[model samples]
Target: MRSTMTNLWHPVIGIQISDLGEKRFMFKFFHRMGLERVIKGSPWTFNNHLLMLYLLNEGEDPLRVPLILVVFLVQIHGVPQGFFTEALAHQLGGFLETFFGV
Candidate 1:
């Protein structure tokens, strides 16, 4: 059961699910700051074309894909600092400790 749940939520295995969680967090944070509607209503439409272009242009460097996606996310969406902040590690640790008592 534990393994099943972990596999279901794991970032490496479930990219869109993981990204959705991150996106929700970002959306809420920005909404609180009065930017969510603006971002969502923006003209930018995210698609796989850029990823395909990157793959074709850069060949197969594993790190390139994620880096490009991160850049695209930041440029297209006005995500909050907390979303990519260094403090995330500490907060994540505290969250795990509180939830799992680990």
Candidate 2:
């Protein structure tokens, strides 16, 4: 998992992944951009299963934090001309939950 993720992310500064047991892993990124990129690119999967992620605060326990929420990028096909707009994207995203971006 570590090797695959390291190769996938390819962080500039580097990253350290620690096994926290119970199928939990802590990812420490040396660069802020890397961290943001990872978080923004959410709903990651491993071994055909969903990989949950959360940003840990100082002194926060990885085992205690809730990993419930995840962002999804939904693809829509065959839109009518002039119907494809930011507002339409927001409406579509709202159907799922919150609309962060188009």
Candidate 3:
């Protein structure tokens, strides 16, 4: 049977799934597979609620968000490729280590 989901592609990366290091690609994949819309909000709100709380606590300027998040935005908007040549490395290392006994 043919796959119903649209294939996720990125210009520089070619096929996105081939670069699992790009977390943003996973979002696009989920979108094409119809899983993104099954939930309430789009990917931007995926972690906003929690991050908002962190921002409220830290009193950090929203303009000064950590680099990891900015990387995601940069990747999405196709900003200066010279700036962010790649996505941040695997963020779940410690979590996976803790949960899955890696």
Candidate 4:
């Protein structure tokens, strides 16, 4: 799994993956850009199962943090000509979860 992800991401500096047991793994990136890139491309999956990811702060316990968030690319088509806007997209997204961007 680690090898596949490493190849998929192709981290510039490098990445360290540690198995934290109970189907949980922690990914450590050597560069902030690498981490950002991975995060921006969230909601990753492997072998048809969703991979939930959460950022771990310095003192937090990896196993204890809530990992309930998942990103989805929703396509809303055929709206009124005047209805498409960034604010509207955010409002619609907020109905499902916290909006990240338009």
Candidate 5:
């Protein structure tokens, strides 16, 4: 005895599941956290603070110039270790370098 069967099926509709990936999800998270504004404001504030310190220490505290510069550098370079990721920190540093010629 022998039995044979043949069947074929296909779905007429489809579904899509969004992955969103890491970067998009991070962007959405930052947007939700309201950190985008801080990210935008950070470099400006950092630079202005440095400029003020430079002006205040011009003659009286000339020795503090290097210290102030070092602090600025630490803040710029340490963004990753603080709150920002490596990529964001690098981008922020680049923006500051471009704007401040530092």
Candidate 6:
């Protein structure tokens, strides 16, 4: 039963989701219900949000510096959780750790 599934977002007109298997339908549900929260807005899902938070923000409050950097990364690069995501994360995170004491 091999199916050539090309498009991943599964976007049914208004439903755009990642195929990464994170109960994303649930995320969509919660988002519709206003239960899925986002302190910073992006097209990324909850899993990607957490990954970016850990790698970019390190789970800090307010996220003054990292927020800007994260936003910059998002604007310039694609979702930080997708392909080649780690290189960007590691480079920025390592730089922050080395100089800014982040």
Best-performing candidate as measured by lDDT: 4
Candidate numbers, best lDDT first, in rank order: 4, 2, 6, 5, 1, 3
- lDDT of candidates 1 onward, in order: 0.34, 0.85, 0.31, 0.86, 0.34, 0.36
Model 6 residue 61 distance off true place after TM-score fit, in angstroms: 20
* Per-residue lDDT of model 2, residues 1-102, tens digit only: 999998988877999999999899999999999989887777788889788988888999999998776666678989998999999988777875644432
* Total clashes for model 5: 0
Greater-lDDT candidate between 2 and 6: 2
Model 2 ranges with Cα > 4 A deviation? 79-102
Clashes per candidate, residues 3 or more apart or on different chains: 0, 0, 0, 0, 0, 0
43: Cα error in model 5, Å: 16
TM-score of 1: 0.20
Per-model TM-score on C-alpha atoms: 0.20, 0.73, 0.16, 0.73, 0.23, 0.19
> Any residue pairs clashing in model 1, and if so which?
none
Show where candidate 5 strays beyond 4 Å: 1-70, 73-83
Candidate 4 yields a Cα-based lDDT of: 0.86
Candidate 1 structure quality by residue, lDDT tens digits, 1-102: 223323433323222112233222111121222333333433322332221112123354333334333122222246475685667657765775586555
Candidate 6 global TM-score: 0.19
User: lDDT tens digits, residues 16-65, model 6?
Assistant: 22343332122221233232233233334332443332222346333333
TM-score top scorer:
4
Summarize candidate 3's per-residue lDDT along 12-92 as a digit string, tens digits.
222123222322223223333343332222223323331111111255443444434311221235455575433422433
Error of 5 at 32 (Å): 48
Cα lDDT, model 6, residue 30: 23
